[model samples]
Target: MLSGERLSAIRAKVNRAQCSQNKKSATLSSVSINGDRITERKKESFKTANSFIIRGKIEENETLTKRGERSLNCAQQRYVVVVNGKAHTVFTHRCRSRHCQNCQRIKAFVWQEKMKEIIPELSINFKNGKYLFITFTVKNPKITNLRLVLKCMSRAYAKMFQRKAFRFVVGGIRSTEITRGKSGDDEAHPHFHAIICLKTTYFKKENYLSADEWGRHWGECLEAEFKKEGLEYNAADYPKGFPRVDIRVAKSADGKQEITNKNIAEHGDQLINYVLKYSIKGSDLLKDGKADKWFWEFDKQVKGIRMIAPVGVVKKMLADLERDQFDYYKEQEKIEKLIADDVNFKADKAVFKKEDDFDYYMESKKDRFQYIIEAIEAKAYNYQCYYKALLSDHLLAFRSGIDGIIENFKKIKNTKTREGFEILEKAEMGLVKIQCERIERLQFICDALVRVGLYKKMSDFEYVNIHTKDKTTIAKNNIVGVMKAVEEKLLNDFNQDFMRLENAKSQDVFNTVVDRVNEKSALIKLVRNEILAAGAYAYDADNCEYIDLETNERLEVIATIE
Candidate 1:
């Protein structure tokens, strides 16, 4: 209805306003939505990572169940202690399952602390020493042959170090690690990282071996030892093969870093920590969605193997330090004590009490200690009763089995003559093997019983010496004497009947043994339930609950009253 120029001008103004409004809306949306999206992504990624971790644990548990081994059920259960209002300390009841991430982290932390102390001592002792970081490797082994390959590699490593070339090596720390190969390469890679110290003279231009030369030497030694051990080796995978060797000169300082004793010690700590950080990577086992099959195989293979070995003077030094520390800790009742005089005082501003005041504090809190000890004693008593009954039953079977073996040996001994001495010797050797194996089994069982808190201490059980005249006679008599002594001791200590049916003509012996065992089992269950119940209320009177530093969320205290 208006003129063209006027209408055009109004439309243009409206368009400009609309554009400005759109820009404002876009700015606001981006500021809010973009930040929210980033946060959501981060949370989602964390959740996904945790899912992978849990999946790995679930797989490990399944494997354990299949193999009849115990799985870690209480891996996340922690005992948290809050010091006044300032500090929070977290403690875990470590399950020590081979693949537990939390347990591994704790072990790594402890190892690092120990290494820190040991490194400075090394630097002082070996003032003119040169260090070398060496890695020894072999071809990636299939899951089925992982154990054999590891054994072969270990023996080879020992042989290599014993070679004349290694005589100049003064001390070293060796740690073994295993990792799963990348996606397409589906094999377990097992290798060793060693920090070896050498005399200063070994680094002389004429004496020094180049990195490549060192690699060649490693290969030759590994191959020769593997061949000697009757292990199969691929000729093609040698000299320039999959089993690569790495050798580097370790320095006390790098780049422009000034050389000082502290720096040198720190350098040594870094080298040691790098190798010992993980014996096996938990993340490698749970790559993608499922657990790697090879990792499980590797775990099973190295069950009882020692992954770290400190050799030469380092070994002795570590052993001495460890012994001293152990003795110190064992004698000290309270390793850590509260800093403040009052429970409600804040730790940040509180002054720590002197050692003289420790006894007074402990005396004041004697009730808590007494409560924990009583609970432990009650549980231990029940455990002892249960084990006594269980072991008594086992002893009966062992006695009958050993008796049969002795009877066989007796026949062989009685029938032996100087003319048939060779036959007698063979029979005696066979019997000795059987006896030693049986005794070892018994020792293992007894040790387990002690470890499980069923027994306070392990009793020494002497074995018969088979390398003597009248060996068979001595062995039989010793076996009989040992069994009789064990039976008597069990009865005396446990205050329970052994139920020697051979001596009892009563037909009720079986029923009597059954009743006793049932009674012990019931008592064990009752005590276990009581212990669990008491544990809930066993908080330290001095220590409060731990609070998460970041979230400021308070964690429930699971203090050890003892």
Candidate 2:
């Protein structure tokens, strides 16, 4: 009912709006999730550390680039979840590097949660146990000797704990922290923070270790260990002929009360977090945005070394708990595997083992289209149909299997269980393989159709929008681009097999040629489908597009037949 000019103006507005929407969708789809993109303040935590490591001069290590890349890409891909009508980005992949700030935060949180459970259990088990917060330190060592100093310190700690004077104390937790000492940039001050569990009887005159005695015992142990490590320990360098050791009653966050078993769970959070914090503080590492000599040395010194550990009773209890959790997961995996294997067995029997008349029909037919179709239908069935079904069945079982594992993981995420995140990762990997395999199969069909002149090979449509973020170019976005990339990867081998298949005339030779194609198809499947369904670009073959695995949709793409 509107005038022509008004209608034209309105249509123009709608077209502009749609173009804007498409652009926004393309940008959002470049990341892990799509749909009204949730924006949040991302912490640039890895920037400083990653720059430091990659820039710092180190011995020729093969893993340096891989390490840098992992850290650089950590948490870049995130899954979007909606809660209460609000969208938020959830946790994704992490490098788990020693100095990664994000990983450190997660590690500290897990430890804090663990201590909440452990402290209360230990307190109840050892009714008369008294908790003591202890700090064991040594005179600053040259930066070059930091690794040796840490090794000696660990040995000394172990030796001191095993001494007869320490018999009254049960097990505890120990964590190492290193700092650039005030002495100079070339010196390192490494120390241990421990929450020691002691029997109430330690307060008695006979079993108690005086402040001076504790220092002396620690000094003796350190001297012995330093000597064993072939390093000279000069008592003259330290005040009072020994390094200083600080001892105090473990207190709640509010300093009003000492933490006992009854209050440990509630009060132990602060102490636990402090003890389980990162080995080197971020402020120390990224101070002045410079990677100094001390920082570089510290990174090398602590490589592959464990900075935190449980001792004595704490060690035993945790080990038992882990073992129990492991057994539970193993039992669950066994049951799931049995069920999955049975299902896969039945599927394989029904599909591959059962004979069909399709091959006979192909043997009798003279048409190349029918032969190619029959070859495709048979080879494709054997190529991945069972594998896909098996993986799909396994993926479902893995999700069901990980319920208990996920709960346990919540309590302590670093705990590795075969049936936990590992299985989930495997299932996800299988899914990516299936996606790639599905695309490969479709490409194979389309190529065969093109050979027979039923479908046309086309080019001219870009599968993804040209976009950039932070100066890094993202890979292709949609399924069509992914399929083309996959095709290119397998192009050489595919060329050889495809040419041979095209020359075949006899049915026996045809089956043999198709076998080669099947062999190449089964060789490998891609796993880069993280942003698979991000774009609306579907592969174009004769103006027909296959959008989803189940639905074949017709899309008129801007393309020219080749």
Candidate 3:
């Protein structure tokens, strides 16, 4: 099914990617600080005097709350988990503040991963799709007017996208970058860097737009937006014509090689990284190791602006990718849960095999608990990853666990005999016991997070794990009580059915009523027995009634088990 050339290309790409990852890991290890692999770039950005000055500025801002200040100071300490001499950052406690360079790095990495997923699908789905890197710019505006310039640019971008000449454009990823001019911070140079996906036919004469044509269209759009906003557009000020708009094929960072459909899967990262790069260069913000008035104003101007966006088909593709990823993780969690509870299950050592098998520590525990911890620590470092792929959000996890309990409770009514009812009740309890084990796993992970400094205090763990356990416990008891009530009502209806049988005019009719009563009575007994076995109720054989486990109150027996 595969051509040799393509298959070899893929294998080569895989090897290259592996080598890149190994190199990055080595770089991180070399710069490790306090058990964390904080890169020199990130350290310079976050630990420098500039960051402190920025924090001070944030404090002076009267609009920011106490919580907001704390968030702005996020990632003061990095939290990580160590496995086999390697460190992985599980939590950076990022505030995602516009002024934070570390968060910008994290955001870029997230977009890189997204592009890896999006590119291949787009290539396969839209066979004729090709990429073009375009830059649209306007004349320099004063720093004070930068916000207004950005607004006009956004409006113009929307207008251009709807034009007839751009009909072949499926979608694009656009990012706005602002820089300071040579004259200093007084003037701002704002521009857009976009990688647009276009149909192959766009290269034809009918659809193609040359560099001058693109500049003209962009200039017209800007003029229209400026007029709409009641700002004067003076064409005579620019004797050289409208602002320049550069349009070219997407290429490598060095601008030597073009990325075609065939090679996009391997080289698309270059194009993606360029477009999703930092909105403002770090040097521009931290000039001379100080926060200038212009820097602070720029931060406020772009406070809530989305730096990068995927439009049209790109947006839809991203949504579909997210849903698929969600379902995939959910199914993986289900499988791992099943494997964790299988008493006789042994993790295949082959899966954990490495170059030095003798150094492996995962075999230290006999139970599947060790296997689970190994899988968790090896795969995920942060609680966000843990929650997304394994544990889910607290409320959602509790609801899912309670739902499992109720589904098992409902199956009790399918039993047809007293002995079968007792057996099924025991089996269902065994299943619910597995759900309880997950709650224990949640506690284990919470303790690990608190120990690693992700959670500031043990009380945080209690608030999550303890509160969830209490809610689940309450729901379980309530469902058990409801099961008991339903069983009682069903038995009463059966008794009436039996009484009506006594007045049957024929022996056949009486025998039919007796069979129905036996079936209904067995189902009621099954439901009642399950409630008792759940420990929510206990049978007081002497009084021939059920006792509530919590309140110690007596409840009428629904159906006796012979």
Candidate 4:
């Protein structure tokens, strides 16, 4: 019953969809899961840094106590769940949804499933409910140089079973790791979490090495590997510390940390889920409930990334995680998925297909791309090239890794100056009308200040702190300009406060050498490198064997009154 025109339109749509399949993104893969790409920028917001930092402590799941293990399994047996506040109870063995499930054993079940998929070679035997949970961590280096790191790690993982390399007796070794191509905050930095299996025989020779020791060894091994690649680093000089490797272990009975990271490489059943998590479009930035508890609006509206941790929220997560235990991991996973869902909505909100320039282009793709894929189930095309020049341009415009720019902008709050500072402040927010006009006016003033002869010594632009879109440049400019203004003001103040150079004259002093003590102007002794100024009180001078200021306390570069 369809009209010929409508049918033609449908066919064209199908052709475009088919052509999309052959297309490739410069920084992305073609795979998609749950509407989330394998590794894409998370599109969402956040107002604080606590969400990820303090919660880092919960990275390791706990081991259950001997007595607790029995109860944990018993609790996992068939149970009833009442949806919401409803009266009727649904017959169920256990709830895996981290929040509503009683005993919430799904975390364990999920782990089991994932292990089989990712590390099929792992030989795990939980006898008497004793399963050792191990975790691995590593510091991320300059993101641009990831090839060496990944290559080294791959080698190390493969050599785990070799006693000569690791110096431990272990057999049946397997490695399963989950790598996040970028961070949840939307910074495209790579990091990996790997889980491995080792023979139980090594525990007998050097048993009780402490779980921390294991983590340290793992970190050290990675360090050695990085050093080989010349990618190792020292964090003592960085303003904010980077991530480090951790080797924490827990017994299967003890898995309690309220923070559930779905990307962890513990088990394999969640392979698709884990893979989707690494994708840029799979973040949970949009949600009305607890998941949307934090983040700034602009971050959400823009690329849907850049959520930092708030001080208060970090404290709460820490307090809650301290009480986190193995008995509740399953419940946390559900909450995590919901969070993931929220982030995904924001990531995929807009899709543009260009590569070189951050702009959309309309170019014929009949030659470059072989086919284009539309959604999941669209028709195919063969004559079209697999890659279209138009798609290449789209990829280039989608900016996700330029975090250095954002970091620099964060420093605007420190600039000082009225015209210059205010202008920068207005620019930081990209606000409307009045503020925008003020910024423009300031720019004019900045240009004029340079041209004015009176302030010639001061550069046209100087460092200043003002909250603006580009705070870094404003701060740098304001500093020089502010200093120039201060110097001129000081000169003017000095001219008004005292006699002029015309009144200069010399005075003669009589050599009245007095031998008495109290009358000799306190008889202070001379000091080496002693600071003396118009208002400085020099009580603790050098050669002062007995001075009031020369106490037993150690001297400091700058002194504070006690």
Each prediction's whole-model lDDT (CA): 0.50, 0.56, 0.60, 0.29
RMSD of 2: 24.6
Per lDDT, the best of the predicted structures is 3
- Runs off by more than 4 Å, candidate 3: 1-40, 47-73, 79-88, 237-240, 252-257, 323-555, 558-562
Candidate 1's residue-wise lDDT over 136-232, tens digit each? 8777776666677777777777766677777777777788888875533557788999878788788778777776666666777777767776777
Per-residue C-alpha lDDT of model 4 across residues 1-562, encoded as one tens digit per residue: 1236643543453322232333333122222221121112111111111232223334432321222233223222111111221111111222121221222223433433433343222222211111233333455433344445555555544443242434432221123232333444322233344333333443465544455555445555665677888875554422333234444432222244211122123432243233212212213322331233222221222232211111122223223433322212232233233223222211111122346632112222332111111200111111011222322332222111112212223333334657765665455334223233433444444333222211122333342322232221211222222222222333343333232223435322111112121111121111111112211223354643322232343222221112
Off by over 4 Å in 4: 1-135, 156-190, 232-244, 250-562
Which prediction has more favorable lDDT, 1 or 4? 1
In model 2, the runs with Cα more than 4 Å from the true position are: 1-44, 49-62, 77-89, 323-562
Q: Rank the candidates by TM-score, best first.
A: 3, 2, 1, 4
The TM-scores, one per candidate, come to: 0.48, 0.50, 0.56, 0.25
Local error of candidate 2 at 491, Å? 38
RMSD to native, candidate 4: 27.9
Tens digit per residue, CA lDDT, model 2, 50-168: 56446633645546656766765655544322222332223245678887765766677666666565665687788767789999989999988889989999888888989889998
lDDT of 1 at 262: 40
